[model samples]
Target chain A: MNNVYLRNSVRFILLILLQVLVLDNINFRGYLNPYIYIMFILLLPFETPDWFILVSSFLVGFGVDLFSNTMGMHTAASVFIGFCRPGVLRFISSTRDYEQGMTPSIRDLGISWFLKYSIIIVLLHHIVFFYLEVFSFHEFFYTFWRVIISTIFTVIFIVIGQYLFYKKK
Target chain B: MRQLFRFLFKYYFFFLFVLLEVFAFIMIANNNYYQGGRMLNTANQLTGSIYQSYNNIFDYFNLKETNRQLAAENALLHAQNENSYVKITNKLFKVQDTTYKQQYQYVDAKVISSSTGKRNNYLMLNKGFEQGVRNDMAVVSPIGIVGIVNGVSNNFCSVMSLLHSEMKITAKIKKNNYLGTVVWEGGSYKTGTLLDIPSHVVISKGDTVITSGHSLDFPEGIPIGTVSYFKINQGDNTYKINITFFTDYKKLDYVYIVRNLFKEEQLKMKGVQHE
Candidate 1:
């Protein structure tokens, strides 16, 4: 258990540094910034308690926010995703079939179920984040375009990251 | 109590979800006052530094252009120095001393990161609070004015670039002295617009626009741009003048921060009078 904790902690730090130092600065056409750090919250063990997931999500996003100078957009999005994770899981997979301590993985949940799970959570997170950043519907259509475009890139990054980092280990 | 405990347990996930969502909502709402600013600024610095390193690698490709600009500036300075020498000789013959305390001083700095293709473009400089750069100091290139300093860190500062929508500089026609506000129209680095100029003013294409010196930030007579085109608004009596900026903001690498030494004293004096 201590070993598991240490590995996760190291991964967490590495992801934060990678996100802020490299990915955050890659503004593809100014609107397509893909935030892959949310993958950390997505990949947590299934048995991790609700409070731990929520708090961890908040801290991760707060860390990103602190560096990006955005006040709470990421934190809010992350917490929202954390809060909705269980519902998304149940909706995608039957409770009896999901082993208590077994983490959500492509091997466990199947690729289709995992994709659905990630899509819903990532969509919710991006919608909340982009809307909050825009802070107004005055440019409703323009902001909507930004949300859609950014979500596409973010989802792509999140999935690629998950595949590369969390492959059967 | 046992029954209540069972009920709570049955609805545990729902309660947890609601609680977490509420927490997120509170965080989002209160983000401005939270410590997020420091974190975001720290992150900006980290990312900015990395970008600076990458930019330095790409900057070598522009060495020829940079060299040409430096040579041009040197030639202009040499001409100005010669004129000053001649004026000194005349003043000496007349037994007069024209040397006086300068109200403005310029400090050279390099642009580490600049964005022009955004709705709210900003430029980051290599100099900051450690170098005596503070918020509201006017930044300019040899060609013309760039923007004002907005935020300052120990060794870096961010300027609200002229490309930002929120940027408004006091500019006037050098030929007729007709003043107007200069603002970016949200995109296209090649052009910005001047608003509030009266239609009666004879503003022609290629007329020079310079800073009004009305603000304590920018000293008078700083070059801004030249009038590219003008048209009378359909309903309003004002003319909309499009300006072609003198500085090629996209190719900007070096800039000078102009500090008004007497600004603090003047502001304090004005405050006393108002009080």
Candidate 2:
């Protein structure tokens, strides 16, 4: 159990470094800046203390913000998603049906449920992230276009990363 | 009291969630006050070096095109100098060079990383503090102004590219000398808008806009863009002019960083006068 915590921490740090150092620099057509760092929050162990989840989420985002130079955009987005995670999980998988100590994975939640969950969270994160980045609705339509384009790219990258790294054997 | 404590314990996660969110909100609101860009300079330097390596690998592909553009620019400059020389000789046998030419120096830099199709686009240059690149220095390509340096590390600097919504440059009509502020409207990298131009100012499509030199950053007469469209607001006296930028920001490669030699002295004088 303690090993799980250690593994998660190591994974979190590695993901953050990869994001800031390599992935942040990858700008495909300028509109598809894929943020795979949010995977850390998505992959947290089930039944972990809520305080730890919130704090860790905040710290992860804050660390990214520190590296990316976008002060609080990522922090706010990550926290919002973090706050909504448990409710989203419960909505998809009823608490009564959820196996004790079973982490949420595609195998446990089914591909359909997992896809829906990932889409909702990724859209929410990207919307909040981009909106806060511009900080105004003066160009509301323009912001909407950006939100859609970025969300699609983010989802693609997240799904690819999950399959490559976290698929159960 | 025991029942209440149990109820609170059951929903402690909810409380924690709210607390974390509120803290995050505060950070977002006060983001501008913190000097986060400075801290990110270290990361910028590291990524910039990596980008430089990658840029070297890809530069070979564009060498022919880049060389062609350089040659064309050289020819244009040579022709202009020749025309000026002939006109000066015709007017006077021996010309006294009394006009004080703008004392501007430029540092050539490579664009290590750049993004154009974003709300807040930024470009990273291969030159940094060690190369005399500093915050707020104006960056330009052979065609026109690109952006101002936002942060600098030891070996690289990040520029707030002209395509960003936050970018506001002082520009004026080259024909009539009417000054206005040019800003990106958050969609097209090739286009921006000029605001605060009065209705009385005569503007036409294809009218060239150049830097007004109202600020110490960029010099006067640096080509910005050409007016693509102009229309008066329904109830307001200001005209909104759409401008097609001269530079293709997406294809940026080499750029020149303009260093203002008298910036510190000029700023000090202005500060003292205001005080």
Candidate 3:
């Protein structure tokens, strides 16, 4: 249990540092800002309680918002994604039930399942995030453009990150 | 009651999610100025300390630029000193505890956290109520006026940065001393709007804009920016002037909180009836 705690903390710190120090600074023409930090929520163990998932996701999003200085935007998006993760997991799972203690990753879930899961989660998150940042229907098309571009970029980075770092335990 | 309890228990997670998201949206709406007052601002101790330490670690990378600016300011200050004036004859008559005195004191502080990209931006400084910082005090960077202090906690204070659309700094055209209000419309951080200047002022494009000091927070004649363009508002008989801000809010690090020592005296006049 202590080892599990230590590993989770390491992931939390590394992802937060990378997001704030590197990804936050990447303007990318103000449209394609990839949010790779949502991977933290995607990679949580399958058996983790739903309540735990939502709270943890909100906390991580609040951490990002603290540095970005756009209060509540990230938190609202992240909570929406967190609430929908279980449904996405069930929809994309090969089996009817996810195995206990199973963690979602490229190595553990196979390439196709991982890709589908990551895309769904990242896309839903980006949709909520970009729209919420605007908070109105005033610039519908421009905001939609940002949502689609950021979602694709974020999904691509999450896939790349899974292959680069995931390992069998 | 038992059935209701069971239903809630079965879907407790959904309820929790809805509650948290509602809380987040409320904060966002409040921050966007649907409501006013502090809403989980960085002046909170937890947020303040984290930003303070982060700034400390990252400040080293900007040492070269900071050093260069300091050196230039040092030279300018040196050139302005009066070293040769003979004032020995006035020493005998200089009295202590005379009528009234200087009414403003500046509390130096560092901006531990700041941002310029948002429509309503804010900067968090290291000073707080513990250090004599109070709500509505004027905060200014070395280059120009920043904004008013929004809230102060125990050890930190949050400022309404000039980039915020709601911020309005009273300013004057230094060339002719005509007054106007400085307002930010929020798309570009580089420029702000100066309104209410009469079209008859005949202002030039390069005129300097400085603080009017009508608001007791700031002293008179602090540099704000230079006028970039102006046109008569067809609807109103006022100049719709655009001015480039002198303070680059993105690079802001240090600020001074201007404390009005005579604030109590100034407020006392409001209690009396005017003829």
**Highest DockQ, which number?**
2
Return the TM-score for each candidate structure.
0.71, 0.79, 0.77
Q: What is the interface RMSD of each candidate, in Å?
A: 4.5, 3.4, 3.4
Native-referenced Cα lDDT, model 1: 0.76
Better of 2 and 3 by TM-score: 2
lDDT (10s digit) by residue, model 1, range B20-59: 6676667556643311223225325665676568668877
lDDT of 2 by residue, A111-164 (tens): 667678878888888888888887888878777877788777877787777677
lDDT of 3 by residue, B1-275 (tens): 99999999999989999998998898676654422445336467876887788889989988887777668767777777776445679558765666767888989899887756444677889998889888888988777899888877888888888876567888899988888899986456778999999988998888899999788788888889999988999978999999998887767777789999988777777556352
Q: lDDT per residue, candidate 3, A45-81, as tens digits? A: 8878899999999998888876665678888999999
Model 2 DockQ class: acceptable
lDDT of 3: 0.80
Badly placed stretches (over 4 Å) of model 1 are A1-11, A28-30, A92-119, A159-169, B1-76, B83-100, B110-126, B141-146, B153-158, B162-165, B173-177, B184-193, B199-210, B220-232, B239-254, B268-275
Put down candidate 2 lDDT per residue, B142-201, tens digits, no spaces: 888899888788888888888877778999999999889999876667789999899998
TM-score of 2: 0.79
RMSD of every candidate to native, in Å, equals: 5.6, 4.4, 5.3
TM-score of chain A of each: 0.90, 0.91, 0.93
Off by over 4 Å in 3: A1-6, A20-36, A62-73, A89-169, B22-41, B83-100, B198-204, B229-240, B270-275
lDDT of each: 0.76, 0.80, 0.80
| List of clashing residue pairs for candidate 1 | A66-B39, A66-B40, A67-B39, A67-B40, A67-B43, A68-B40, A69-B40
Local lDDT at B226 for model 1? 91
